[model samples]
Target: MKRFGLAAFDDQQDDKEYEGISSAVLQRQNNELKEQLAVFQERLVGFAKKHNSEIQANPEFRSKFVRMCLSIGIDPLSLFDKDKHLFNVNDFYYEICVKVIEICRKTKDMNGGVLSFDELEKGYFRRLNVDMGDLEKSIDMLQSLDGGFEIFEIRGKKFLRSVPNELTGDQTKILEICSILGYSSISLLHANLNWKPFRSRAVLNEMVANGLLWIDEQADAEALYWDPSWINVLHE
Candidate 1:
């Protein structure tokens, strides 16, 4: 009887100790999580202040910042029910959007509001010495407004198609192929896509009208059509 009592007492003691250990472990984990969140919020504020120029000027870095915030359960672009610190998180992006629109308006006649993303970025920054956040993110933010600003890829290149032009299935296919071939003449289109010459020409001309493709008249003088949106090798 005495031994039984001692064993029971020891078991109860072990249980009590385990409860204490569990509580401590949970508390430590909670503290660690809080510390991590604090650090993240601090980093966000730091970026908004110290790297303001870079965040606004270099779009890739701004995108990375957005990704980082998202990974930490934070969205800088969200405007409602946010902590005060995050209120202005995306203000810089909005400002960049205004400047982008101005540039688009200024160059509307040349490219039908369809400008290369690189050219758009360069043009926007060249005019004013202010920062513009990630072009993609700024574009995303702009969509919430009345402007029909968006990005599209054709012929392996990135174009900021500010107009509301939608690509048809055949047009999309042609751009995809041209993106791979760098430049496609009507003959090449008929050969690769099995398209009739007239059909190929029709599609190419339409793309030119949409400002999705450019006529490379100077390069080879062979009436070659190229999608300037296509990157060097391939863009998908």
Candidate 2:
């Protein structure tokens, strides 16, 4: 028993020593990574400044530069400096974010708080001299805020949701059905999804209450539930 006790103590001491060495090694590695990152950042900044004109003029080049920055855990926008005016990368996305907010507010009455990238491109993207990458980055910034901005995909189509409330699974599924023709009715849900009348109506009514679906009461057979995004597509 005495030998066992001494051996246990020795094992514990070994573990402690190993832990200390591991921590020291990890700390050194972390510091080295930080130093390397700093050097890379400095080089990137110099490169960006040198090619500022090309980045601004060439959309493809700008996108590649933004992607490279992100790959290195750097936000292209964060490179902005008021004193130096390194480049206008920050201003480009900042302006796009503002425009997105304005467009959402302007069409809130028509499309609720959800908007498709398709609709946004038609409305302002063409005039703004921006591309899909720029818009995606702008929306990414918005999503980081507490403002309930989120991007979601349904049936391979992406939609930006601006409201705080999340859509339930059933609601999202119904929207997928609506994507066929941009509208779904109780019969449609029942026939395709095999949902009972009560279940279909319950989900539809809840969606209408949440402003996700608009009711078209004048349908020939039953009330048609429409995603407002479809209306924008029709106009286009």
Candidate 3:
């Protein structure tokens, strides 16, 4: 029995020694990987600096560069230290943010601070010469300021909401129906959604008050509530 006890103690010691060796090996490998990543990042910073002019001047080049960095789990923007003017990509996105805000503010009355991504692309992106990725990044940066810049999807259609008010569930449902039919009337809501007449009317009226829905009193029957964003689509 004493011999057996000694044998067990030796086995435990061997197991602990194996674990220690495995841990040390893993730690060394992790350190080596981190060092490699650091070297790669430094090289990338150099490359970005060398081509800074092209990256800023050519949107296609900038997009490809940004995509390559992203694929490697790096943000090209991070290559620039806060004080480094020549390496700064933030300026590019900052300009986009300013332009987005200006467009939203100017069209707030026409679209009620809610514009479809398609409309935005058609009306501004071509002139601004930026891609959707750039606009999305600018939107993310603006979110920190809490200025109600957000993107929401209804029925797979994306719209930028520039207003501070959050959409209620009922309001969103109405919007989804509008996405399908281009307009929502009290009868349509009741027939399709099983909503009571007053419930449909109340939500529709509230949206009209918010400038989210335009009233078509000239419809053959009941007034139809329409999304202003669909006006262009209707014409097309």
Candidate 4:
């Protein structure tokens, strides 16, 4: 009887402790949500004021507003309650939505006209504080959306596409080396491989031309950086 009583007491204590931790986590999440909502509200208000006439006249604004709200884990069509779908969404949804909206708004403002897909992406990279190559996977996610953009080529130079995707196998390998070594220099990659140096350098050059890699011209010695999308594959 004594052991049984002690066991029950321990279980109760554990239950109480768990409940406390759970409560604390819930409270923290709620606070974060409140702060995020405040920022969203501020941005929305600014966007409204900045493009009052355009917003009012455009049907796309309503769709985008609803999408933005949904992305932020809120159902714009339903009552404004945070707990309605508590189990259905995670914190990342709200975080990413906030980031996306901020980027979109900034793109709209900076372009001084209707923002193109490429401009929005430029804004996204700037907001995320990531290099263009590092943002490829996240860019893929954006491309999956209805208005996703893609880059096009005119003459010999390539430009940003409204939509982007994962790198090809060879491109992936090149990016992997660049990301891992933090250098995309043709000579470096060639020396590192010690085999097929010229072929590898040519491929790297092609990738740069395709925007799968970027070069840092400001560096005293030029350095190549791979797109972040290839990081996972390289690790595997």
Which should have the higher lDDT, number 1 or number 4? 1
Per-candidate alpha-carbon RMSD to the true structure: 15.3, 14.5, 14.8, 15.8
Residue 28 error, candidate 1, Å: 68
How high is the lDDT of residue 193 in model 3? Answer: 92
Assess candidate 4 and give its lDDT: 0.51
Whole-model lDDT values for every prediction:
0.68, 0.82, 0.82, 0.51
lDDT at residue 88 of model 2 (Cα atoms): 60
Count clashing pairs, candidate 3: 0
Candidate 2 has an lDDT of 0.82
Residue 19 displacement (Å), model 4: 62
Q: Write one digit per residue (lDDT tens) for candidate 3, span 1-236.
A: 34565576677777899999999999999999999988987787788888877777887877787778878777444554434454346766776787788889998997778888788778787654566777788888988877678788987877888999988999889989998878999999998999999999999999999999999999998999998888888877
Ranking by TM-score: 3, 2, 1, 4
- Give a tens-digit lDDT track for model 2, residues 131-194: 7777888889998788578898888877888877787789889989988898998899889989
Candidate 4, 107-132: lDDT as tens digits: 43222112233333453445444344
Runs with alpha carbons beyond 4 Å of true place in candidate 3: 1-87
TM-score of 4: 0.33
What is the Å distance of residue 201 in model 3 from its true position? 0.4
TM-score of 1: 0.48
